[model samples]
Target: MLGDDGAGPLLAEKMLANPLEHWHVIDGGSTPENVVHQIRQLKPSLLLIVDATEMGLMPGDIRFVDPDLIAELFLMNTHNMPLNFLIEQLRDDISEILFLGIQPDIVGFYYPMTDAVKKAVEQIYQALNLHYIQKAFEPLAICEQ
Candidate 1:
């Protein structure tokens, strides 16, 4: 995890421990731009950017973050560049993008995450695992063999 700024990485750590066969998990750290190149190289059909974001919601709340709907003033994540710009660059190749965000209660310089945030992390882990497992086995062909 990223101390105060790494809730997404914490979720990623928990998710990658078991590792779903059909998915690849990468921790983008505080600056996603550094890793955007790697993601662009893969050119995956789906991209999910999970982060601890400031979306004017309650602390420890979870909400779907929409790039198009997000205003520029809310660009308070630790990254130097805007994430929407990155997404727009990959727009042509990437099929879908989902930004899952968890609101943080406190972001002090420390190792321990707050209890509310931890609960949010678990909720995200349990919920997303089921969805990914179902996604892994979906029909990929037009006609049966």
Candidate 2:
């Protein structure tokens, strides 16, 4: 799973490149509950949350968080949680989780992603040993497990 507009689309593309992995994207525009509901339904083994809110990330740099840690952070910060809640509530359901956040150079209406964000995406793909796949990929299971 992936969320946040800053790097969500890019990460989704990278995950799709790996034929063995399946990815679902939830952007900032979606309500928080919608993302939480999807996580409940999919029961994904991992989650990649790319956001600017996480601490210690430089504009061109990246940060990684264990899914469990993210869940704690969410509970402490937002009264309503993001997908991290599911990771906590269903820890056994997840194999591993990574929160990949980039400090975006700019985030504004009618603006394209900064070069730094785009380059970071490429770096993440290399780190994950994946290539861009140019076709439809598998859908995340919509029914509850």
Candidate 3:
């Protein structure tokens, strides 16, 4: 497995262990495109996508990225399709779409996540947990390393 490239799945596993009250977290893996049909079935009002992205920032830095700007940010090309295209497919069903991007330190095969990126995953999990607890529908603030 590629280092911090596994961040999204890692976060999905953590969320699954605790399980959110209203949120449905799916570990789409390397083929997120495969989940589009399932996501459409759920028809959630808000869709949050988490992934390790290359944003020219520090390894652990996290940002709330616009889907339209993902290409410019140079997201990791591990998915079956471009992320923006995926977002476009779900746009009609999902009222709000949020992309939570974590900057990866290493993307090589079999490399484990760096300390900073691991910490970022924890921070994101906690933030999402708190966000749902408060029943907030607004976008999250940028989470720094």
Candidate 4:
């Protein structure tokens, strides 16, 4: 949870209910170094970052971003954190790394989330159980292979 206000709380709720069941909430008041230290110590299998960014799908939209961008951000932001080195750093630890974002209508001060973002949060929570094949990119047709 990287946001300063409402986004953090909403994401915390969803993560608490997540089937995988590990949740940590760090207050935005904390310094980035504190955050980096905590992550290093815990070594979470999946680091789901919910931040205010220009990137990502709007409310009610979901998409898997290329992992390369993920690596770039982690490196530049966290003082060359190990995740910057290679996806393999997470390979032995994390199996899935997801960045669930809600395009913020407001950030930095407390304000109610936009109706669209709120609806999206709920939708994502409900859809968490939808079965997705573990490897969806595999060729399904013989000719394609």
Candidate 5:
């Protein structure tokens, strides 16, 4: 319910509506650590985490953050476990971990997402969907060559 803090969950809901094959979209909510077991069970090669972050940038700005810089960049600590710590726990299980950080305008409770953030979310959803669709067709394209 915290303003743009809902960015991650909103993205998760969008993803659930039209999921990609072989991809799992989990809404870790404010307690992402709780989903560690579920994530590990999937044995995914790549894990992409999307969350609202404080980057001292314009609202709606999105960046593909390096895991090492997470501690320095992540100012909001809404999650139960520190994001860096959670990453460390799953590093062994997941081959690649990606953090997509969206700069949030307001994080107050019961506030709705700002237009900038909402736009960013839609952009992210489209990009991911396009990427997966292209990937899904790769093998077929290669086979027909």
Candidate 6:
């Protein structure tokens, strides 16, 4: 995994500080080909990928990355493989796939994460807890027989 390319794992680290009751925080690193097998074993209802992806926006800008929009992204700072390629591998087993991409400021050795990206990480953590995760599960019905 590349240095700043560890964005998703880093974000997962910060979010795990308070620790959600039902969430499983995993740092799959930059290349998670094997992690896909683990995810398939667990069979979670939703799968969200958080990463540093340049989308031609401000350095700290965060956006919902669409699989179709992969080609248009500016991802020189990321690792060799495109995330959408990994997503495709999981598509057969994963019903819901969502991506949270943060634009990066720096992407090399020994450099601390940018203040802007840090703020975006905090914002995303709050957004996931306060809004999105709940909404994602709203449509599912529990059966009691």
* Alpha-carbon RMSD, each predicted model: 8.8, 10.0, 3.8, 7.7, 8.6, 8.4
lDDT of 1 by residue, 59-143 (tens): 6777666666445445457666777877787678788887776777666676578877788788777667677522322221212
Q: Tens digit of lDDT per residue, candidate 6, span 27-110?
A: 677666658778888787788877887656667777665665565443443545777777888888978887777778787877
Report the CA-based lDDT of candidate 6 relative to the real structure. 0.68
Q: Rank the candidates by TM-score, best first.
A: 3, 5, 6, 1, 2, 4
lDDT of 4 by residue, 1-145 (tens): 3332355457556656565334565433223233555655677766655433333334434333345565544312222233334444444566665544444544433455677656655654554435332232121122211
- What overall lDDT goes with each candidate model? 0.69, 0.52, 0.80, 0.44, 0.79, 0.68
- For model 1, the local distance difference test gives 0.69
**Clashing pairs counted in every model:** 0, 0, 0, 0, 0, 0
What lDDT tens digits, residue by residue, belong to model 3 across residues 1-145? 8999999999999998998667798889988988999999998998999888777777888777777777754566578788988898999899998888888899999998899889988888887877742232223233421
Lowest lDDT block of 10, candidate 5: 136-145
Q: Which portions of model 3 show Cα errors greater than 4 Å?
A: 132-145
Candidate 5 — which residues are off by over 4 angstroms? 132-145
Candidate 4 has an lDDT of 0.44
**Candidate 6 — which pairs collide?**
none
Spell out the clash pairs found in candidate 5: none
Best by TM-score: 3
Q: State which candidate, 2 or 6, has the greater lDDT.
A: 6
After superposing candidate 2, which stretches have Cα over 4 Å from the reference? 1-4, 17-44, 54-56, 68-83, 130-145
lDDT over C-alpha atoms for residue 29 of model 5: 97
Model 6 ranges off by over 4 Å: 1-4, 72-74, 133-145
TM-score-wise, the better of 2 and 6 is: 6
* Candidate 6: Cα lDDT at 61: 75
TM-score of each: 0.79, 0.56, 0.87, 0.49, 0.86, 0.80
| Candidate 6: 10-residue stretch with minimal lDDT | 136-145
